[model samples]
Target chain A: MGPSLLLRAEGLKRQLGDRLLWSQLNLVLAAGDRLGLVAPSGAGKTLLLRALALLDPLQAGTISLQGRPPATWGLPRWRSMVLYLAQRPTAHGGTVEANLRSPWEFQELRGRGGWRYERIKGWLQALGRDPSFLAYDAERLSGGELQLLALLRALQFDPSVLLLDEPTASLDGATTAALEALLIEWLAAGQRACVFTSHDSEQIQRFATRTLELRP
Target chain B: MTPMTSGALTISDGRLALSALLILVNVGLSAALRLGLTRSLLVASLRMVVQLLLVGFVLEWLFRQDHAPLIVLVGAAMAMIAGISAVQRTRRRFAGIYLNSLLSVMASSALVTGLAVTGLIQPQPWYDPQYLIPLLGMVLGNTLNGISLGLDRFMEGLRSGRDQVETALALGATRWEACQEVVRDAIRVAMIPTINSMMVMGLVSLPGMMTGQILQGATPDAAVRYQIVILFMIASATALGVFGVVGLAYGRLTSADHQLRLDRLVG
Candidate 1:
């Protein structure tokens, strides 16, 4: 219940079919915290992120954002505040710009202000992408490019918490560094925090303020 | 052109048996091609013959009775059967899928048929079996196809596009917003057959109801008008039924929490 706490999970549990993946899990994220998750492959790292974002049902326990439960804020609002970025994010069958702007089409995010073109352009430039990248068909983009697009799509929404599942798995060294820098900058801007899983232990050591290990 | 006053020639039981001989042609083709469909063809043909004969006898008895309640009961039964058949045609099922199909079929068919019987045709009584039963049957048959196609397409689309749907949801979309595209595609798929049939109705082939009326000694002009009314009724009912089933599916597949409940789907 710290004043800077942005997200809290108490006694979270998850299972896939009859096999229990993890249980008695707890998380507390404070403003400007970059929490890295360490778990072996097939250990349900993605499921934990989904559970935190309310994208999947929780088998047990509670999750709250900024001292408020998901039910009180309602799903759309809660999800808007705590966004989950998947490793293989969907492109939505349109231009990259359209995919980025798609979230604004929802009434839930309308009041958050529409997508800003100049800001996206700046981010693209940082990621070594030209303005022409926006015109590229999202479905045809390479895996790394899609990951960038997905990141921008989430970043523009300015959510308080981000649950990133292997976000840089497909990116090369240079782009991964740039993405980490960009995320650091984003986290510095507000009472923001993120929990991310990285297969690369070096990247996790470099980026995370602290690490949480999930053992089977 | 002069109108012929002669009614359709009645076929005796012997002549009807003679018509059954045509199946030999299909049986011959199946045997010659080694298609191995002879047994299935014979069984299907027998079933069709028995089913039509039973329906004919039931219609005769139903028409003889002027009871409104009994006619309505028959209509409900038809809707229930149509609902079951609609679900049976889908490759996927979920809890309450049958109920969803039944409610959608029953609601749309009842609405369109009631409007047509009372508002347009205005038979001696609204539940007059001769008119109500046939009209309801036609509407229910078409609606059954529409709901089946729509539900199947919808469930499959959601299953295949699970990532896209979850992506939208994570981007702060409501359940309806996340599923709008799939729902639209499903409804469009459902409406295609109905629209295509309407497009080439008279030019491509004579409609069954119109041909039946003409065979029963009705003038072509009167039969054409009834056919036109029936066509419009079928179109309306099919559209409504597609929307009904797709809407219900949308509700079941997504939840108040804006989560995609793909776990609810049973393949």
Candidate 2:
């Protein structure tokens, strides 16, 4: 009967010099709620994703997870709980394996656990990718392939929240449907939630339980 | 009267002309390559020739001054120019910061060379242009390149893929932790050519320093000592200059909040 708070933003406003990007914006997400954020180009969708990931400075507002402010949660803990996947994944400019393993060197992951390289192979197989894809350079990956591989890598963290910016923009209809099913299954397995942005109305209609429009 | 011929040393007019001609050809071909770099090369060539000639005249005058302060001033100027050039090649905005780093490198480098030349090599009038100037020039030039490479890549790495950098920061990585890979990779790449040179110095090539020393009437054994010392001094100077520039430039490249100020790059 009562709403739970997984992530909450209050009175959020961002401005660059005299130009305001977003103002008086507010959002909240609870477990198992798959939300879609829709906006036109330059509506700061990507900026908002980054800001939610604690990767950008907010002009004014407070973001809280589980009722505790991010300042109190600390960056490492907050970021681990909310993994932001960009439209174009920033490949490490190296081999696929290197890109996948890049985050292991971060302070939060360092010495925490050893990578299960075999699980990576299984995930790739499940995603219709070959294990040998690991040997190829990231720069050589196709847009669709990159998004898929990046998704697999992000899942390695098992974050409670996945913030995806147009994750399937380059995917074909079949692949998009498959990915939607996969995401639904993932969210259904636990109370984890996902907030994503996309321009595909068909995919949004199929995958999103709730949609929010940020119009310019 | 031909200048006094000593030992196996003979400065032939034809040999000097040949060397000059080779340098000219190298410059010409490099400029002629239609690589959008012709203008920059021509400007750099003219600048180098004029600057070196002017330095020759100035150093000749300073060598006669017999004052320690004058010699120090000459060395300081050399260091300052090297630093400024290094900074310029790395995008040219933070001239003052890079100059300070360069001067620090030069002072340390010159101190090492000065001590060795005076104490061990015992070259009378230790500021002898024939010895001190050439050694300083070689060491400073190599170090300047290392500094430029390190600083350039460090800044570029930070500016591009800034989100990934921030991701690392958000993941509780310290400032150094966030930057460790790019910094290490830049420094390693900067040292690569130098490392290869050191490895292949004697087998694949006759180094300019040794050849110059031998041509100037020094024995092969004596020349080798100077060459070895110069090589070690260059490595020291390069590492020091690179580290110094990277550390200082990192501050200028980033904002107070430790985020890279991309606007500062173009500004």
DockQ for every model comes to 0.85, 0.25
Candidate 2 lDDT over residue span B1-267, tens digit each: 121125464648688556555556656776677456656756786788689779779866755666667666777788888877877787545535656566656765677677766885656677665566667788888888897888778777777657666656544455566677777877887787788889998899889878866776878887788778888878877887777777776666654444445556653
* Best prediction by TM-score: 1
Where is model 1 more than 4 Å wrong at Cα?
A: A1-3, B1-7
| Candidate 2: CAPRI quality band | acceptable
In Å, residue B170's CA in model 2 sits off its true spot by 7.9
Name the regions of candidate 2 deviating beyond 4 angstroms: A1-3, A15-19, A90-102, A110-141, A188-191, B1-53, B65-70, B91-134, B155-181, B200-212, B247-264
RMSD (Å) of each candidate, 1 decimal: 2.7, 5.8
Q: Which ten residues in a row have the lowest lDDT in candidate 2 chain B?
A: B1-10
Error of model 1, residue B87, in angstroms: 0.6
- What's the TM-score of each model vs. the native? 0.96, 0.75
Question: CA shift at B124, candidate 2, in angstroms?
Answer: 7.8
Candidate 1 CAPRI classification by DockQ: high
Which pairs of residues collide in candidate 1? Answer: none
